[model samples]
Target chain A: MRSRALALPMAAVLALSACTGALSDTGSLLGRDTLRIGVKADQPGLGLRGPSGEFTGFDVDVALDIAERLGVEPADVEFVEVTSAEREEALREGRVDMVVATYSITPARKTEVTFAGPYYVAHQDILVRADERSIDDVRDLAGRRLCQGEGSNSATRVIGERGVAARLIEAPTYSECVTMLEEGEVDAVSTDDLILAGFLLRSRDAFRIVNAPFTDEKYGVGVAEGDLSGCEAVNRAITDMYQDGTAEALLRMWFGDTGLDLVTSVPQFEGCS
Target chain B: MTAEAPPRPDRPTARSRAAERARRAAGRTTVRVWTLTAACLVGIAVLFAVTTGAIAQARDGFQVIGHGAGPKVAATADLYFALSDMDAQVANVLLMGDEHDLGAGREEALRRYEQRRDDADSALLHAAQLAEGDDAEQENVRAVLDGLGDYEQLVAEARLLNDEAGGGAGQPPAAVVDRYREATDLMRLELLPKAYNLTLESGATVRATYEDRRSATRLGPVWVALSGAAAAGALIALQLYLSARFRRRYNPALVVATAGVVGLVGLATLMLDDQAQQLRTAKEDGLDSVLALSRARAISTNMNADQSRWLLDPERADTYAQGFLEDAQTVLYVEDAAGEVPGDLAGYGAEVDDAVTERGGYRGRMLGFLGEEVRDAPLAGQAAAQQEVLRAYDGFLRADRDMRLIAESGREREAVSAHMGGAGSVEDAFDRYEEALIELTDLHRDTFDEAVRAGDDGAAGWDVLLPAACLAFAVLVLAGVRPRLAEYR
Candidate 1:
């Protein structure tokens, strides 16, 4: 009788313990049947949620391609929505095995996540209402409310390094910022030309990019900081994607009709090892 | 819970014996009732603490969102942008020789320069006000403000030297170059770094406040609710147990206590639920907008620096050529590459032919981000601005080719002349392109506030309601329990 009573308490303790998962200090990205790849669900061309609840975007395509290269079936790659602010957290928490969002590789970010292959290089540019003609260049930015998204240091470079006297506004996503611009809440939205093109193509609004890109941004795949093998594998996939005519094909497939400079040339890859 | 023992005459009869047993049972039940009462009070106290703590956290989070992340970050972004623009204006002045000699052009550049400088001053003032207390931010702003005065004097001296040199077709005197170089160095290394530091500090502050708001302890609500429910359940069971044991239909005090405890549990749950909802909305919607603006400003600032570098270092001709080419190709998707400049102008003609052949499409821009002779690129004319960019770039590339030819013949002076000369010069072509870029940059600047408005709007309703909800929770518990305590009395 006593043994049974103790067994009940032990089972209760076991039940409570089940609530706490293993305390993993870093991502233990072992081989699994399904790989959870985090991406932006709101960034239209890079990562977007479709009507069918499936994700579609350049990042999604890239992630799919990488999965194929990893010997994992494309159908097995699970997509998770990750925002700019949550990228590091998601990786650290092991909520996703890899991040294929339009992740920019920077030294500061390297502290939290390892990056693989800068598969594409994007330049910083501005988007304005189609009829807006008074603003055309970076120099004309004084006294304007520029909308940019959070969690990355993309906007400060323009204001801090360039010395444009502009007001700064923040948004959670590029799409929402575009909505603000459309609503006349903000005068302009600025980001990578590639991202802006995605917005323009999907927005169905009269928005145009002011053919002036100022900074070079190298887009890389992000993995948890300690996951060296995963980072290396991602880099390999990117290189293969470029070599096998896949990257060019993908760009044309998604961005060919957008009037964006769809140069199919693979971007310079950053160091992997 | 407390009850008096009734006076009983000893008898074996049913009535007297029953009364005596009932009294004994009531005395024991009183002790159990008091224990439950203490347990209920402990649960309520814990609930009070949890809810109140959450309220304080919400208050702090709201304050930081309102005061620190709100206007302060926006002002800092402006301050940083203005300082860089001012530096660019100075570069423009340097690029234009003898501000008084160029008729209408002179006046226009001077007017724009002065206006830009004024904007910088105003932005600095605004940033200082925003950064009033923080030692690091203040220090950085002060350094930039102080450095600007000296930078202006150096620019003036350089302009004077260039004017005295008759803004010659040939390279200006070494002294003039030295003066300009000094000014550029000061802006690049000293003033700009300080401005960037100020921006970094501001960004850090905003992120810190955001993290604090997001990192609020949730331990309070979940635990409090659990304890509260358990306490209420215990109170109800105690009331039922006492009524059955004492042979009474109901103990009014115990009944009231049980109801009061249950009500307190509901109120606590309600309060926490409200807080949780508000916190989620604030983070997802409001703070996100602030972060977006921060990114746009940083990118623009970096691009501005690249533009300045193109003009500041004319000596590194090939480097500038390649940098400009890559920057153009990356954005405009222009398929043009700077062919190898021959050893001593021997291969200049061949290089020109190669460029002309490559200029038609994406075949000219580097492929594989590293490969040469990239091909099969997209066409231009997506937007009017885009067309304008292509035109300016085409004009500049042609001009750059001419400069290359001049540079090759070993006539370094003639090359320098073509490099920085007026009208159709490499410098002039780039100026046009940069003008377009500035216009684009200006358009985005005005959007910084509106981007985050929706998020801010969602968060605005969160701040004032949290404390009131918590207070309501406490009040509801008090009103429900007070009558029960009086029944005990």
Candidate 2:
């Protein structure tokens, strides 16, 4: 009789464990028919949320492909605008199912949320005015004004880690940084090469990106913390996107005209752990 | 006397001594009379100078403050309104999409936009002229003009894209929307704020000048009265001395001289007092109301643009709605005591409607331009005109709510149509409101013009009359004492 009672308790414990396993960090996302993907709204060719309530860009297309593989239609996907600072918060609050914005994967961020794949690796570069001849490299930014977009560590990385000693000027976004550069308010803007390339498409004669590369910014798909299934799903979808040649096509469509070397092969995925 | 005259030495005589004493007395009397006459003439001269100077100052104030910066500042107000309307027309044109005949249509919208642009340019020119001496203001004007150029380019690009997309009966494609967003953002962020700053700087100047000029005008009467009293007093004193010394009840010339001095001084005092009153009317009843109404018109125009923006872009509808509510609050804020007021048009509409329905009449719970207009109606019929404005404004609020409701219920085209179309639309209601406001503004403007004209008239002829009166007063003073002095001779 004691064995019988113990077996019943053991069965209940096993059932509860199974239930807990099923309800994961991404339970809300995978179970839902619609996927809400966070994206940048102002970035011209990366993930610009256009005026007619539609999203277009490399990040946007990548997000849609991942959503499609996860059994969500393009029409069922909703694009939520997120800044670099709010990506983690948006995932934590379930405001977005996944963030496919230009979110870079790092050890510090990995502790907060699970990153799926590098998807694309972009190097940090400097953008200066067309007439600028003094600044050709990251090291040359010493004592010159550099734009620091809000919630971005690019300017600080150049000034702090690289020991550039550049005077940091602040703006809310990369778009404003470009405006400031055009207005001669700032000497240079440093960020991911892809973002600069997007802006360079508009006014090639006004601004030129300095080809000097510094830091490697591994762009990742962010899901909620401990959402191992969601992370694996995104990584698999990203691999398919590359294998099916959709990645190269989307990159060509958005950033082909810009003279940046396009990397089309499947990027090494960050571990779902 | 006979004994005195009997034996007179050749050296001295009593009659000769008496004659010498009489001659000395007559000389002293003549000198005293002349001295009093000169004092009276000096008093009259002071009165003339003070009166004429005050009048001249009043006339100068009217020319400089009333006609100079006053109209220029008013032009700035027009610029603010025109900038807002231009943006509104842009939104309306986009809302028309591929269809050209929707509501007032794209062509009509474009025509209005062009007209507003021209108006804006004209205003900028005026602002530039007004800002000629101020380097900082001149820089601001240049910046605004540059910003406007950029804004227009963006708008033109948006229109071209919209036409190319040919999206039927709704919002154009994403590209067009993005371009339009960029244009509107430029207008709102850079252009509108800078324009408003120009207005504020110019408005402050107007207010400061009004205060200075008004104070000068107000104190004019007191100064004139004091000098006039001195002149009249001196004249009366001279007349009394002449009458008593000459052993006559009155000297006709001196009496006439005293009357003339009192009459002229009284006339000068009355003229100054009336001019002061007119200036006060101009500032308090006119310019203040005109400024408030101008701000109201500009804000309402922006609010209407927000409505069109809400319809044009569904993605940012809530943002535009929030902006509309904020601007609406600025135009007419109703105070809520319970702290339960929601920060949305729904809640605000309820509050305003409830206030309007209150039986005891407007309990002064309302604030903002509208409230100020009603509370401070200085002229006759102004209060009634303000009431009509309030009524028309209520109609506009209702129409806006209805348009939003239709849009929310998935009838966006109907909503857009109602916004841009004929009678009973939001446009119609807004037009009514604007008309009422314009009527009230005209009343104030008319008062200002009248005050300026009357103020000029009050000081008229005083320049020549002052010197002429002074000269005549001097002549009359000489004439009044001439006979008395001749007695001593």
Candidate 3:
């Protein structure tokens, strides 16, 4: 009787256990031979979808490098589309094995998901139409209709703390805001300088960065929360890529011809510390 | 009177008496038949008039309310939003500099702007469709469309000049600002006023629909009542004549026919009453809200243009500033002929007043940054320029509180970055002040969309419901009179 009673409880416990999926643990990426990465599909040089339905961008290159570090082949890595708002949720829900979509590293975000190396620093800058002369700098943007990517704090910080009098419009993605600027829907689009440069590369002679950069944004790889081992592994890959001149090579390959501020060395890692 | 007496039965002369009796019976039959025919014919005529008149009234009402008022109001709102959206897009395009051939984000902005232009085009088409036959209305809509295209071209020219002047330069040339000013002036003085006039014309159209609906319903009941009363009077007269001639209590056929006419009159009146009341409610709540919201939106757009003009033309800064104040007064306060504040908004009204004062404080600070001697003329008799320069420098010195004290300040990029939010820079501070003014404009805009939506919802199903009611009354009149006509048969 006791054995039968124990069997019933055991079956019940087993059923409960079967219903719950496991969280991604530290260094667990290697267990699966194929890696799934969430990337921005619209950021031109950072992470973008090209013709022939292929993903190509600097962020794609970095993800390929990290996958190679994990002993996974570049062809085996699948890229999932992630928007700015969905990045954190996508990581928590196991929608992606990792993310390398020009994700910014922040101390507050560290509490939700672990960040690996900050491979790049993109300063906050403004993108205006080719014909705008009233706005020479951030100050000239006063009362202008300036659009920013939704969920980005670049415009918010300027409006909140700096007191820039710009009229802020939020779009779902950087691409939409960029389109608005190109068509003259909004006055300026403000975000990372390098991201804007990527836009400039895509749209010829229609736009340029007007004012100097205002804030520094460090880009990092996003992993599951508390996955320190996975974060560390990605950081190691970044470090090796830098040491072997591969990181600089990729940077030159993607942005050397553009007006972006190119860097030869890897950015100082945020370390998730 | 009893003039002749009949002969006795079963006599040879009784044949003559039989003939006289037969002739008298025939005469009585003829009288009864003619009276019944007259009553029935009059009843049928009145019923026909009531049904056809009601139907005609409903048709006219529906044509005005459904095809004219409803769609025209929607068209006006679309035009207003489209113009406002286009103006904002122009500003946005100017802000994003030369984002072609390699620029990503600004190009996205350009696409968004094109989408807005498409929206405006669609709105124009819709307005044209609403006003299909009227030459004046069509001409007016075309004017707005042409004006919009011109405005876009001007904006493009401005963008081109601004891009050429950029050339990786430190500041944009004065010519760039001038081009932007021209574009803005086109929007404000020419394009915006045309849009406003279109809205007013649409408002007039909307008013006509309501007036037509009201007048249509008003006359319908009176005609129904008048025709009904005449039919009843004819039937009653027939009844009295029949009662006297035949010595009967009442004619059942004529009574039923009279009651049918009365029923039709009541039904038409009731239906008309419901229609008029509902139509009135829709007009007051729905159409009035649209008018108020349109006015509010025009004010906000005007303010936006004024602000842009102020930044683009330093020489006309004071003029633009005064214009902003006047527009702000109109937007914030509901004034009468003498410019007296009428507290129509109750508690929500205070926000405008507060925003105005807040804007004033920021404007004072910003005008100084723009080198307003009136604002930044720090107490100096012979040294106004010296004191103002010293004060500006001091403000910058205190600006970068947490920033590192310039480790060999030769890097132009880093120095600019470090001084972005610095104290004495006053750049960000000016932005803060401008933000408040924008907030003031936003407060007015937020309520406009809701008003339009509420008005639209309230006005729904009016045309169908009213016409359906009229048809129902017609059926009720036909049903009530059919039984009376059958009794006559």
Candidate 4:
């Protein structure tokens, strides 16, 4: 009797243990459906929203293509607006399926999420007023003020470097930084050259970006870590895009004549740290 | 021993000894049952707590994933975009310095150059505001800005001299242009890298954030499984003790306790499985999609901005425009294509067609503007044509209203036509392309936003559900164990 009584619960516990294996087959949890992404709203030629409220830019086009390859229809994929500080948390907590808002790949970020493909390469630079005097080299503005977007790496680089002592002003976006410069609230703005070019184009007569790159930045797509299959898939898509003419066509469509040497060759996976 | 046996004849020793043994066994059974019950209850409670915690964490992780990806992505995107623009501006200023005449056109170029500089200044300020890194980058940018101001003053003086010479019709004053070129070259080669370094540093931080999120997502399920296993183990032990104590095969309370443990474990396992899957999908599919989009966009934007800046400098405008096109075609197009054409290849094809048409029209305008000068020396003509092309392009670009109209209508063909019409002057083409590119960028932004919203919707409510489930499972397990304890009493 004692053995029989023990047997029942023991069997049940074993049965429950067996069910644990069911947890291992996690495939069904991700239903077959479209994934939504969030990107920048105002970046020119990259992720700008049209007056008709249609999303179209180099980034948007690439993201759509990725969705289609994932079996998501064009109408199925949605978009959300996100700023600089919000991208990582969003991806970690599952707010968005993906983020294509000019994210870069780096060793530090590899700790949190998986990344795939350097779809585009960029660098940082400085912009100054066309007629401004007394500022030319990085060392020339030692005691002056500089503007950058809040939560931007540019701000940290500027603030962290040795032998430089400039007041830092923060803004939410590159455009706002331009406004600050226009309003004389800061001395200089540091960010990616492409964005500054947009500002210069818009301002027409108010600013010019210094024609030298301060750093190399390669933009990558971010996903939750250990999603090797998804990472591989995205990597493949990007690689395919590079080989085909689609990337070029999109580039021409968005950036009429910006001089960026987009690399056509596939990028090798330098394992993420 | 024989004497003792004789004495025990009246005592019934064997039967008494057997009975005492039975009673002691029964007492031991009772104690074991009570102890087992208590252990089971405690195990169940811990399991519940752990499961609940895991669920809660999973949910929180999901929310963080869903909500946090945007800003970091945006910051990096903006940084790249700004840097690309600054590079173009620097290049343009240098090219402008090569011109012998600082006439109205040259002055206009200078003004545009100044504006680009201003924009760069603003971008730095914006970067600083974000506080992503240390303070040194801000200082470096400031120093560069200051140096650029000094250079600008020198360039302005040179411009004055050239302008004066142009008005007087004497030997062209090339000295000022030379000085301006020298200053620009110095800044471009030296100070610019400081800013680039800053961007690189920030990129590191953004990448780190991505990694942190990835690990958290992956670890969530393991926690749940462990907790569930622990709970199940305790319940089984309790059931064994209860069975021994009562000599009964069926213990309803023990059975209930076992069932509750199973249920809790099962629920936790399922929830964990689901959460893991979602996180995996996000990691695998989502990150790269975002990166590719951003890279393509950044490159494209850089190309557009550079093209426009080239138009501002007529003398070397064609060279710059050609350079811009080459870069765009190579980086933005072929690289982004990867391999097979996307489903929406038509849109890309249309865009390419429009670009080609625009380029052709720009070439024709350059030829027209150059007239005889272009014919005298083909190389000179090419140079002259490039300058003329740029001017026509600028004119086209500046006509924002027409470009906006074409963009609003989604009439790629019409837009191309309008762009060609405006390409009679470099200035014209510049205006049209600028408007067109801006419109295209806007469209992409909307598309990205929609994708984000969909992702968010799919992942919602996990945070609250996880903790609640854990807590409930614990309560059920404890309740089931309580009846077994009462039976012991």
Candidate 5:
């Protein structure tokens, strides 16, 4: 009688496991040899798609390293361009196995899709023209035209929580924002320092970051909800990426020239549900 | 006679009085004939002035629309083509990368780019001259010039950066790509649009002139006929009155004048009819074809540039790919055709070609540059020339498909090699297509020139003949009436 009762619970657990595995976006990715990871195409050093028809930068390297850890070859990894707005939808629709597109881990986002790691803790900073000196801190952005990238909430952080009454000017991408800033159309560009660092690499002396960071934007790898196994797998990969010094090397290679305090350690991972 | 009037003391005799009355009546008849003849002469002169003025105006209308603004607008289309080609060459040079000795070589590409720049500059100067009177056109020209300056600056920056960071074929530095993106964006968004607008503005002028002038010429015959009839009727009335009052069968001079007026009216009507026909031919066949073909050439050139951009910038490969398809459709469109791949072009071209030749199954349905060309193939050899152009364009589309397939199959280097290959390259195919288009344009241009010439020829000698005929008619009328008046004396 006890043996029969034990078998019933085991069968129930097995069925539940099967159901989770089938529904999990990350679980499906684990089974496949080829993995499609969403990334940013326009960012210069973070996840830029280069002229060689290849994706290059810090995020790309991390994605490849994670894929390698997941037993998928680098060649088997396909990078799809994903913007801030489409990250969650891309994961839910199975358009991407996971998005390493500078996605931030937030409580609201965690409700929609599971997040793997904080992989890199980026600070929100302000970018302005090199010659401009009147405004330095985030507070000084008041009444100035601040470029807001489409689908990015960086503009809200300045005006909403910070109470800065800065005027928001929208652009399709951060690259376009930089373009606007270069042409004097926008007074400043506010985003993650890493993204700004990428733009600074190309412009040389045309722009500079204010270094006054406010808000800790913990970049995360997003997976479909209920994909606990997949999320755990990604977490393990993130840990390996840091322990093996691959993360540090990638960060240094892409953002070394840009004057930012490079974080060289594993970030605090958001626990998988 | 003695019973008629028993004379008063003042009257000498009844016969003498009757003779006086008869002489007064004859003198009055001569005066009436002279007055009517003078009035007929004035009416003939009026007809001469109106008919001659209409002919001269028709001739001038043909010159202005057919030769002046019409050709100038077509020349601005060359400017559009040149600007597109300049960007294409820039992309080509960048695609060459560290490999300076490709099929055409970077040096040759740069040289072509410079040549196109010069051509564009000259075209701009010509456009400015054409847009002299209209403030809006002048402003558009100025805007294009400013945008061109910005575009050139960005291109120079891209080239400098690419040269500094020399890499393999089809792999430019990130910074170079960024600069090129800016430059190409500005060219596409600002300069090209403004240049096309210049053409559009000038084309509008030609169209307005054509409508106004053609309408005038169309009604010229009717007005000339009405006035001529009035003049002829007056002459006939004068002749009838003379015959009745003077008891003569005919006045030879007056009869000749009436025949001259009728003949002049008939000739003027025929000339005016011919002028209207010439104007229609010039506008519908000549200028219309030139504009459409110019647009086609420019669009095709830009489409080829999109191919190079696709090969060079892989990040936006799909975007460029989409652009290529859209441009292809613009050049030669087929309904419900989703040209996702290069192979799809052949079917689309075939469908369009079938519609072009059948002219019945799908007549008026096929739409685009090539569609319009086939629809209105009015010239002697124009239909055959349009078919040749379609064939050449099909060849180019095929080559483009092959290149794109190679690129898509992960053989980018081979694709680039094939693209830069001299003989069987996309560029070569496009050049042949351009050749065919030019030939067609030349045929239409000839027609335009010929129509204008015919318009001038039709109105020839009317200016002097009209006044001379009027003078002759007047003298004939006076001569016929002078004898009657001399009878009174």
Candidate 6:
């Protein structure tokens, strides 16, 4: 009877030992089969959801490619609508696997997650009514009302760093910024050069980008912390795409005569430190 | 012999006495041995539990450091690079946009701006990915991209207007220039910051992650060491008890159990030690070194871009470039004087000085080149200097491109420019600058990788050791327990 009693405890101990081994397995953490990606739903040429609810854009294409590489089919991937303010939080809290949003890589963001690729490049520029010829430089907007997304780096640069004493009007989206400019609610809208090109093309005679840009903004793919393997894989894919002329082809397709140039032949990994 | 023995009334029968003594001794030893074995078994189990806990803690520590803090640092570095690239592109675009010369000079500037624009967009995309929040940030980014598209279209129209007005004549109409200026101003004032904040958002997240990872990883090792000691102690006690009870020097079961506990404890300790060492090295070499070098490179890029812009419109561009240079100098000073240059900056001090001297020489030559032109005559020599600058910039860019290629290809060259001296017809001076930056980036990367490897290696070692120790302690306990069964039998 005593021996039997001891055997029960011994079995319990062995069971517990097995549990420890299972607990130590790191593979479970890596199993992110169905990934949720945060991306822009409005920006044409970069990221926009179609009528069929399929996301497409230069940035979207890159994101999709990355998903495909991760063994997830395009249909299996879920797209989460995201904005500049929400992207970081969504990524940090595990709400999304990656953000393919036309997000700019900056010193402030390196603190949150691992970033891969400078998939696209753009410059911050001003958009104005085509006929209006008064404003010549960022400095001339001292008294003009400038529209840009709130919490955006463009607003910060115009209102804070560049010291353009413009009446800073915050918009919810780039379209809103453009609308404000069109409606004369604001004198101008600030954003990336190629995006401004798309808007101007749509507007035709309505708006134009200023000759000078205020800043350069490089777009990257974001992954959760410690996901270096994922980061590396995505970076390699981007680099391969660049080398294979996939990036150039995509750029040509979206931005016809906007004259956007591809700077690096491969996507470079700028370590977050 | 015993059967033949006669009974003695005083001593009793020999066989009966011997049997009685043996029975009493056996009973006493059996009881004692069983108690000792039970105690040893309990000790071994407790030790194993403690050791296992310690090893688990060590693993957790490794995770926090490797996956958490390490990533945060890497991400932050990326953010800085992105922001710097953005700033540089903006400067370049503005410079290009300001150029009124409709010939080759104007086209070159536009081409350069377009290239820079592409770079900025790519950086922004990466930043967006790193940024956390919800769809709000993504929406904001999309909005900015749209706004920028509008801005570029406007610039293109203005460029066309200027070209028509120029008609290959002496100069374009001031009105056309004004139109171009207006378009350029709108884009710069309205659209640029929307993109820049994306970077700021990314930087903020990077800072938070770094702090969290650092704290979490720091606490893992102590827990592991304590648990390991407990397991080892239990195993030793079990072995002693088994030896004493068995009265035979070697108790196989007890020996196995003791060995198991000792092995487990030893392994756990080793793993913890290695991880701790790795974390320390990463902090000292990788994080710090990479941060400093990246900061310097970012600043330098920003300055160079501003310089390119200033060269386009000497009057206004110069001022902006000067401000950018000051900022760059500040970054350099912080990197150099803050004692963060990763080892002695003394060795590279001479090289840095030489680069600075070369920069000064170039500036002087540029000034003389510009002075020869009539100040009032439509900035004629600007085309020449613009071409020179373009050549130099492209040279630098090509070098940078090659360096990235080399790094990606895993070809570890001490200096980047060593391999690509013949790819382009670039000035040797510009090549040197590009090479220097590449070298700096590579040096820091190497240091960071070494630290990471150390940490990983340490964790791997611990992974092996902790399990071994647990098995050893278990064996020792089993060895100790087996002797008690013999006594019971």
Rank by lDDT (best first): 5, 2, 1, 3, 6, 4
lDDT of 2 by residue, B34-93 (tens): 778877888877877778777877876787657898878888878878998999999888
Error of 5 at B121 (Å): 1.7
The digit string of per-residue lDDT tens for model 2 on A1-273 reads 223533554465556545544554334456569989999988888888767878888899888888998899999999999987899999999899899999988645766888888788787888999899999787799999999888877886677655679999999887899999999999999999999999987787888888776655789999988776667667657756765688889889887877677767555444464
Candidate 2: regions farther than 4 A off: A1-273, B1-17, B337-342, B359-364, B376-378
lDDT of 4 by residue, B1-489 (tens): 111122344665788888666756656665665565556556656665666666655555555444553334444444444545444444333333334232224455455556656666665665565444544445544555676667667656755665555432112235644664565444433344344433433444444444454444455445455555555566666656556555657656456656756775666566566665555444333433344334433454455544434333334433344345433333323111233211122332333334334543422211111121223322212344334433333343344335435534765334323432334433354544444433333333444454445444544564575456545545555565556545544
List, residue by residue over B210-261, the lDDT tens digit for candidate 3: 6545666655665566555655665666667656655778766556656766
In candidate 5, residue A228 scores what lDDT?
64
Cα displacement (angstroms), candidate 4, residue A43, comes to: 44
Off by over 4 Å in 4: A1-273, B1-23, B38-70, B83-126, B129-201, B240-326, B333-475
Task: Give one digit per residue, the lDDT tens place, for model 6 in A18-100.
Answer: 56434433222134677788998888767777898888777777777778766777887888888777898888787888898
Give candidate 6 misplaced runs (Cα > 4 Å): A1-31, A128-173, A176-188, A201-211, A225-229, A259-269, B1-275, B282-489
Write model 5 residue lDDT over B1-489, tens digit each, in one string.
111334357845878778767766766676677668777877788788779778877887877876677778888878989999999999988888889887778888999999999999988988999889866567667877888889899999898899899888877788888899989878875677667656655665676577567666766776677678767877888889988987899999989999999999999999999999988888888888888888889888999899889898887674566567656765776653342212233445566556555555653245567765776565789878987887787788778878878887998777887788789988788889899999998998899889888988888888788889889998888898888777766
Per-residue lDDT tens digits for candidate 1, residues B1-489, read: 346554545646888678767766656655665565555555556555655665566556556654455555555555555655555555545544543432224566567667767867876776687677865457656767878888889979977877777663334556776886777667654665455445444554555465445445233345455555555555565556555655567666555655655665565555555554554444433333333333333333433334444444556443333344433332333223552212211132233334434445523432211112112211122234434434554565566667767755766545544655578776687668655544433333323333333334433443454345434444544453444445434
Q: How far is candidate 5 from the true structure (C-alpha RMSD, Å)?
A: 27.2
lDDT-superior candidate, 2 or 4: 2
Clashes of 4: 237
- Report the C-alpha lDDT of model 5 over A1-273, residue by residue, as the tens digit: 223533555465556555543443434556679999999887888888878878888888888999899999998999999977789999898899888988987644666888888789798898998899988787799999999988877888788755799999999888899999999999999999998999988886898888876656779998878776677668667756765678888899988877777767555455564
Quality class of the docking in candidate 4, CAPRI style: incorrect
Query: Could you give the interface RMSD of each candidate, to one decimal?
Result: 15.9, 36.1, 32.9, 17.3, 36.3, 15.1
Candidates, DockQ? 0.02, 0.01, 0.01, 0.02, 0.01, 0.02
TM-score of each: 0.46, 0.62, 0.43, 0.43, 0.62, 0.45
Worst 10 residues of 4 chain A by lDDT: A21-30
Candidate 4 interface RMSD after superposing interface residues: 17.3
Q: Give the root-mean-square deviation of each candidate in angstroms.
A: 20.3, 27.5, 28.8, 23.1, 27.2, 17.0
Q: Give the range where candidate 3 chain A is weakest over 10 consecutive residues by summed lDDT.
A: A17-26
